[model samples]
Target: KKVEEQNFLIRKRVLEYDDVMNQQREIVYEYRDRILEGDDMSGTAREQLGNVVDRIAKDYLEDDFPENWDLHGLYNQLEQMYPIGIDLEELDIESVNRETLIHDLREDIVEAYGDREEELGSELMRALERFILLQIVDERWREHLQNMDYLREGIHLRGFAQIDPLVAYKNDGFEMFTELMNSIWEEFARFIYVVEVETEDHNGAGPTQPAWGSSSNTSSTAAFSYAGGTAADQPSALAAARAGGVPEEIQGAADYAYDEVEAPAHVETRVVDDKERVGRNDPCWCGSGKKFKKCHGA
Candidate 1:
């Protein structure tokens, strides 16, 4: 009874952790779906631009007089982020307040974005926007997940410091999530303004395949080795054990059988070298006891 209670508690904790991840996963998937459905992302891009401008202004203009402002340094930073040319004299800081400067900068940014859209055409610009946003979200989310996992693994150590591990985990996870959101905005702003679009073919070109999934052009086969039972049979045996239909000895045996099985190595497609061409009539390089045409070339 005590062992069963412990197992239940462990499962409950795991489910709690999974619930947090599932909520975040749903939000990301919804964003991706909107992109796939061709939702208008210009508003999102503009919002991110505002965020960038605000951050830059805070960095350079906070608690400083116009005479002491690093206009050249600010220009260099803005130039790196967007294609706009910034001239301090042209901005006429003596005549305009900081609010006006920001408003003018935003207008210039919007105009520059409009020009880029015209250059790329409407359809390609939309596609590029979707691609870039999704790519940045996915990459940053993946890194966030890794950081969360690392935090969870070490969170137990906090117990030694008289802290509750669950509480620590929750607090740290929230902080990490906030940072992730900020990073998403920054990445979107940086890429949207500076991304270069070439005149090459855009048809059938999309985001790169995710690391965990099998490629569309390849087939994956899983192979498992176990001592007591085949992979298919072990699941039913465990179910029976869990249902109390199996005796204690049988349950122990089933658990032992599962523990003895080693983890399966995932299969991936092997890359073939194609630097040198083999003539169809030439001998087979694979050393098959047959003509090239009858062997690999066939």
Candidate 2:
């Protein structure tokens, strides 16, 4: 009967924990469904912009006195996320407050976003916005789930501090979910401003060069012997020869495939030329005062 009661408690605890996850799941699924249904997310984007700006205001302008605020940090935060140029000198420093700062920053950002829409065309910009939001939302939700698992695993430790474990878990979980939503929106907002689009050049007529070497017309194979070649010299020789030196009539062999192989059982040694070999008692050629036997010769 004791074992049965313990089992029931365990099952109840699991269900209670899952209830927390269920609440979060509904929020994430709503985002996914809205995106898939082709909702115009421009309003969502504007709302997120306001949220981010409000956060920046709270972070940098926590003090009532303008002099106490981190104006430089505020400028940097805005510049990094939006392409809008924020000249600190242009801002009216004497009359600045959190509300006015948020308003001006939002205005600049909205203008900058408008400029981007004009540059890319409204249709392309809309498509880019949807793609970025979808990706960030999906990715952040997965990471949030993993983080929640980690939190649940260690949450019972809070009981040692005289806090109820379930209450602590709920409070911490809510904070984490809030942060997850902020990050998803933040990245989605930033990427639309900073992403670069590359266009292909249709006028170029030359054949693309092989990646191994720069020579476009290289068609001959270069053979290298491991026994005779030093590691340092082999790379340059192979690269240079294959780059241009080989005859055009001889086609190149198959490209090299790299695989890990066991080291040879036999130990290999560099063969010293007789003229270069030092006598046992000779002064070291390295210019150390010691005899060869005690120096390199040993």
Candidate 3:
């Protein structure tokens, strides 16, 4: 009888753990179904864009005084996400407050988005939005499920800390789910602004291309160059965005194209003295727009 009771307890514990994932699965599936139904996601996209901008603002504009704000950092950060037209260097700093900064950023992003929609037309743009959103949600949810399995395997260890293992698992799971949803929004917003549709037949003779492809040697790093970028393209900001920061899904998206370039054989090599070497915290010598520690130093 005692052995049978122990078996029952084990099964009950397993069911309780699975219930957490069950709730999450329901939420994710319902979201996926809505997308599959071909709902107009422009409003959702705008809301997410606002959220991304507000998140950046909160990070760099939290201070009240203009002197206390990091406008350069803010500009660099924004470059990683969208190709906004606002020139921070051109802004009148003394007249600018947090509200002014937010308004300008939002206005530029909205304008850029409008231009993209006009270029692509409403039907095509809507189709692209739905396709991208659904792809991201499905991929992220699959990854989340794997993560939940890993979490469940170790959650029982919390009992050693004199805590209820099941309670700890539930709390941590909730936090992870929240992060997953936020990441979906961030990635979708970033991709929409930069991705472009291209075809193999530039002369318009062959059938339109169904997708884009990228290839690089294992030793070479991949970088995405937006097709419609303006004079605001910052090589430094692009380097920072590509510096091990982007999600794999974005890096390997269907619309992205990259190339591998080998260094010239005739170039001379120079060894710098230790004192002249870039500090780990200093800017990288490669002009990748990231600190040495985060770039080559890493």
Candidate 4:
């Protein structure tokens, strides 16, 4: 009974951790549903592009004085991210303010995206966007789950520092989740701008495949068994005496213990000759009040 209670508590604790992952899974799935429903994603993509441009601008142009900026580095970053075709040396740095630079970069990016749409066609571009976004979200979410598992396993060690383990786990999990969200946005945007669509021989169309797989049948069972000796399987005292005490095999069987048993209401009692066999859930013959499942029967 105590073993059963402990197992129940352990399962409850596992569910608590699962709840966090379940919530994250729902958010990602909702995004996937929107894509599948053919919702417009250009607005979202534009917002993400703005964020990327802002981050790069901050890195290269970190001073009020235009002369202090690294125009070459800024150009390299923009070229790597978008298909902007402008020479840094051709521009007058003093005349090109930050607003002008941002506006020009945004125009180039928008044109690059428009070119891709023209090449792939609107329908194909929508499908590609959905595929890329879903793939990035799934891959990053899987990595995040692995990281959270590692964090949970080691979090209890924080107790040594006089901290509550649960509190530490919650805080670290939240930070990891935030990082995961950022990674999804960055990876999704990068793939969107850079993905190459391969043309197929079939009608000059791009290679296409189903985004998800078909379902399959599955089955499960609850019963469990282990190799070991039960109390009823033990040799009788007279039989043991005749065999020069318990045999090595019988003695070794003592180490194997049953970890669970049915309740008394579900068990049947019987007697054969002068000896009675004990139910697996009954109290042990060794005089311990604990259930046989956790004591000698164990």
Candidate 5:
């Protein structure tokens, strides 16, 4: 009975050790890969991805000290150790005291290259890798958004599908996200071909970021300015009326035959004592040289 019990315990230990070993191998591969070719990632996202990795590792390794794993905290440390963008006021990778963050991660990979700490190591590696991928993806996305000035103003793509603008943006944001992920992978592959080791914050903190800049890479853009614009061709009222107008349609011209009426021929004709007055009796000086009774006065 005692011999059988001992054998059962040994078998259980062996299985546990095997699980640990498999996890450690995964951690090593992932860590080394990121150290060689990782880009940059944000803090919050790193924490979240780290949690995912931790959960996956726990499922496989089934460790007893699950509570000891705080990947979010570890990621914060990493960010403080290796920030991204430059700011005159902010600390940069160039000003850091450590050699390289990748070095530290590599050392961690070497030291933890076993099943015993496989779960924790896996979390660390995943967290680091995801952060790197995230940066590339984010840079690409920001560039896309900034370039698409139309989208910056916004689009009602959903409205084309008979949906609301907000709904459309939300729906298309997923498509955008998928494309961003693809861009990240493609960029990662490209970077891996020639990228080399570089210094980052030894404190493991990510960098303070910068504001998004607009890109001039777009093919079509309507550069807008509020300052007095280029003058546009505008039509005069007469031209507009001649082309298409309410008054033109409402009032047609009158063709009155005014051959005998005096008032109709001229307005306010002078009746002063002049040497040659425009007399009606004197052959009607309106050039209708007829007798006064037969002409305008009559």
Candidate 6:
């Protein structure tokens, strides 16, 4: 029930953004047509149109962009179109955020106007939906990051069983990642299945629902292996454990043994705090009284 309300809120916010994007698009088209016919847009029209163009750039940046992109080619062309006034150079047009934002638009809009969301339509709606999904995906990604980092650096716990320390750490890390995967799966399912679009808004007419379960492309359930490949390629924690990899927490714990990473004999490693130092040393002085060895050791 609470999730439903939250979903509604998310959709409401998305719709508002879509509305803004559409307005910007309408204005851009109006002015673009005038310019094509060799007519000058009045100062008022130019200013309004400029505002719209700015939004196109802004909304695209805030939407579904991939990492690492280049915008130089588009900049040159935009400069030619709006030269002497349009000033198409707004924010980092090539940023991942920008590309994602642009990419989020409908395929038609993308093919029609390229990076410019200056004329909104289905593309604008697509952006709003993607923005919401991306927000959720980001949270999931952060959780995955935690598990990956954990798996990549397991401790040498094999001393107890007289096993190879590296092997022990790997196995431990694999287990940890499996547990993390279960947690991630539960959360992902909850968000996707239980969460409903909000119906009542705090100030506005809450989010309008899509035609019930309309989003076919929304899913975030994949095992991730740290230090192997990208997160998506990872085997779920369960899979890793079955395959004999270490647990995630243990793997992450391994790095604790060498964290202050001694500087080269010449490069003075700054004296980090007691806790930071405990990141590797003996027992930490904290009243928990657990030896740093037992508490946070590799």
Residues 84-150, model 2: lDDT tens digits: 6568546676787767777777777777878887986664555555545666777788889999999
lDDT by residue (tens digit), candidate 3, 1-298:
9999999999999899989999999998877766656566788787777777877777887787888778889898888777879878677789888886787787777677778889766655665566566667877898899999999889889898999999999999999999898888877766776666553543677543223222231211122322212112212222223334344577776235442334344768998775367898998888889999998788
Q: How do the residues 235-263 of candidate 4 rate in per-residue lDDT, one tens digit apiece?
A: 22122134333445665664343222332
Off by over 4 Å in 2: 1-6, 198-298
lDDT of each: 0.65, 0.67, 0.70, 0.63, 0.38, 0.40
Write one digit per residue (lDDT tens) for candidate 5, span 172-205: 5546545554454444323221222222342476
Answer with 2 or 3, whichever has the higher lDDT. 3
TM-scores, all models, native as reference: 0.57, 0.63, 0.63, 0.54, 0.22, 0.22
Report the number of backbone clashes for model 1.
0
lDDT of 1 by residue, 13-125 (tens): 98887777787778777777776565768777776676677678667765436776666777787776677745754566666577667776777777778877888666556
Give candidate 4's error at residue 4 in angstroms: 13
lDDT for position 187 in model 6: 37
Which consecutive 10 residues in model 4 have the weakest lDDT in total?
217-226
Candidate 4 lDDT at 240 equals: 19
RMSD of 5: 30.3
lDDT of 5 at 273: 57
Poorly placed runs, candidate 1 (over 4 Å): 1-5, 64-69, 85-104, 200-298
Model 1 poorest ten-residue lDDT run? 217-226
Q: Which stretches of candidate 3 lie over 4 Å from their true place?
A: 1-9, 199-298
Residue 267 of model 5, lDDT score: 58
Indicate which candidate wins on lDDT. 3
